[model samples]
Target: MRSGYSELLGSMRPTSTNAVVAGEADPSEVIEVSVILRRANPIDVSRRRSVLTREQLTERHGAQDNDVQAVSAFAASNSLSVVKVSQGTRTIRLSGTVGQFANAFDTTIVNLDEQGAVSRALSGPIFIPEALNGVVVAVLGLDTRRVARSHVQLVQSQNVLSSFYATQIRDLYHFPPDLRGDRQTIAILEFGGGYQSADFATYFHQEGLGAQPSVEWVSVDGNMNVPGSVDDTEVALDVEVAGSVAPLADIVVYFAPWSELGWIHAISMAVMESPVLPTVVSVSWGWPETLWGDMAISAIDAALADAVALGITVCISSGDWGSNDGTSGQTTEYPASSPHALACGGTVLQSDGVNILDEVGWPGSGGGISAMFPPPPWQNFGYSGRAVPDVAANAVHYKIHFDGADAVVNGTSAVAPLYAGLIALCAESMLGSHGAGFLNFTIYEDFSAQSTFRDITAGSNGGYSAQPGYDLVTGWGSPNGAALLDVLETLSFAQVQLQLS
Candidate 1:
């Protein structure tokens, strides 16, 4: 208990020393906590061997029904009520008093004096019984109000980036307009945002992308689209960009409750879902890897590994805040830092509105060595640990049709769906129904050799500079439709050769 407390103390960031008591912790104040349990199938082994069927993956990986009983027993032992048990999510919800929870988890309940707002959090180690220790991966809901930032931005300066829309940028980067991502679906994750169908209609019609695109909205963890000024802008941008780039592909917007679990839930749901299996999943959200506890990181990465196995490409925005990633100091962003996912970075494209001029890495593009994960086998850049942003795209001053009008936006957030659309196009044109299975292996080891990516040989993202090949800032640079297709052809041939050998 003492050792665990010491470890937790290190994790907690020190707040203002002045502790003005917002309220006394009533010993009997009821609170709810969610406990995430470990899944049976290990993600590392199952990935890329073969994309598992939905039934195969679920039966082998889903939380066993009996596991819920164990958590119920634990709650009973602690004199707490088992409010809910989710078989698929592998999370058990427990409700108890402040004192009961404090005693049960060996932690203290405290009300934080966070300026004008008051919030609750556990002050000590959240310890589970030895019987449940291995099964319980994480304890959430300790703090009811600490929110992670959404990586969305309205273009702050037109001079810095030269306002460009999705159509112009895609053309400049050599994306074929004819492909239109037919026979593919893109899953866009949104945590706290709502989308209006009228807005989508207006945006698409204005962009000349056509009307009545196939779009589906999914609610996860009881979080749904709540239309707000800030929230609508991000969600709207994602839908608009994906639609403009891949007009024929169906779009699925999975909305979830806020925080780490909300983000993870959306990713896992996208992978495991059937009948609407997306070839590409775009996530325009993330926080510093450290902000997500070890358990949260591990669980999320495990789900992403399954995504790799399922032939569903998950593309996450590296972030818009460069090396520091919008934090107080330099830190690597999550989801992007996860080895199984592709980190999409940002660039400033120079063009004469209709033709390409020059492209440079945006200083706000998030790229750095990850402190959380070791370099994956595919990474061969002499990077000691995982390096972010496998590819780059123009983000600065993107004139996107959002909330019914053309609005200029900037952020790696816009970059994610752009890449997702490309993946969808590649899947339809090259791989057929099988899709591009776990792109990194082919990306780094083989396709990269065929001049698959436009190597950005100049500019920097603060800590790292764009050089000839695979530097931290612009990664292997932006997409070239012809070269990307060439890569697909090359990989397909290599697969045939391997089979024959």
Candidate 2:
């Protein structure tokens, strides 16, 4: 019989047709790859109050030792070096030359030119030994093609409807007055680009934020804070928005390469291995579901599940390309489409200093049904698949420091970090030190939680229209931050009681 992972391997494409083969990869150049192992027991973090420590989770759900040994033996036989292994993450890092990898996986490795970007790609199927067929799930880092795009767009001067500083937007959303996300940590994932300390200083200073929040940069796969690319705007927006809103919170940005392997590594390291574990993680980059292969999607979804099980909140920007998400037919972006994530959508807002004068769903906001994941029990909208966004916030007309200067940008990218900052404030209000994990159940099941939102009954994102209650375009609408804290506090109390019981 064929391998069970055949579909995933077949679906995984190294690059689009636009890329042309430049040359063969250097045979002697040593490279590293990440091999994902299957877990013995699956993890479910839905509506879970009890949290697990890194050690406990590893013991209960991580890969079996036998599996790890088998992979190591296979590496030894294939002349690949075992660089590292993480049982908690079910990953094994192997290093070998390009020629050894080609022979081991039964594929050709080549250099490809995709427009102006150059990448290393795989030209055929990755073979798996019959003995380890079911044990190994995914092999990443072989292909260096860019995996996803940041969803931020600069507003043309002529089309600027309204603009506000990141702090102004925070206050206009009615974020809790007493809480500045004290003692909370927000981890931001960046696939490319970087942030400069000077830009951050200038931004907070100009915004009148007396003291800047503390920030730390973590590199994954040797990717560092090198700015000046188009992606610099994305990095700037995330760091500034999240930091400005939660001024007392610690901000940790994990920089990684723009590949599937790099993406997975960034998230795993942030959630599992960070020095100061993050209470919430914000991801502003994503691709439509159709673009991600089954293996890549499954690997990421599993990692997100691990995050929630450990009581870490994962926030994802739904998308900025309307309901279609830049694909034909109605589609949603991955990671956001994953049920474990708090998918954030976008809105256009007109606020008069203290109150919201008008708020409507941004036409470019991404909201739709998922093609890969089933809706969790929390979602009761009768949709066959998981819904796109669980909540929304003002996305357009935001002031951010980008590429040495200030720029006005728009997209759901702003909303994820905005909500991530908000969640940090909520986490601060909780009775214990646990992070606010997996909020979809409460927001969908409890009317009290639903009441915290300012109902948006206007505008559309091409395929979906915003309505009084939950709609595809804006989900439960934008939040009233203080009210949300009140509801969350009550839930936290109940959770504590249940835990004690």
The lDDT leader among the candidates is 2
State how far residue 460 of model 1 sits from its true place (Å): 1.5
lDDT per residue, candidate 2, 20-110, as tens digits?
A: 9999988898999999999878777766546898888899999899999999998999999999999989999999999998777767899
List model 1 lDDT by residue over 1-501, tens digit each: 734332322223334444444654667888777777777665563224766766676667766666777878878888999987765556677999888877777777678776765766556557767666567777776654344556778655535445765767778777765678887889988877787787888776776666345888988777777776677778887888887788888999998866655666677678765467788999888877666667567767777876877777789889888888867767888888888888999887787867668888988898899988888878877877898888888877766555566677778888899888888877877754376766666677775632767778888877778888787887778888656866776777777689789
Clashing pairs in 1: none
lDDT score, candidate 1: 0.75
Q: What residue runs in model 1 are displaced by over 4 Å at the alpha carbon?
A: 1-32, 45-47, 64-67, 79-89, 93-103, 113-118, 145-147, 156-162, 273-275, 430-433, 447-450
Clashes of each: 0, 0
Q: Each candidate: what lDDT?
A: 0.75, 0.87
- Over 4 Å off, model 2: 1-11, 47-49, 157-161, 431-433, 499-501
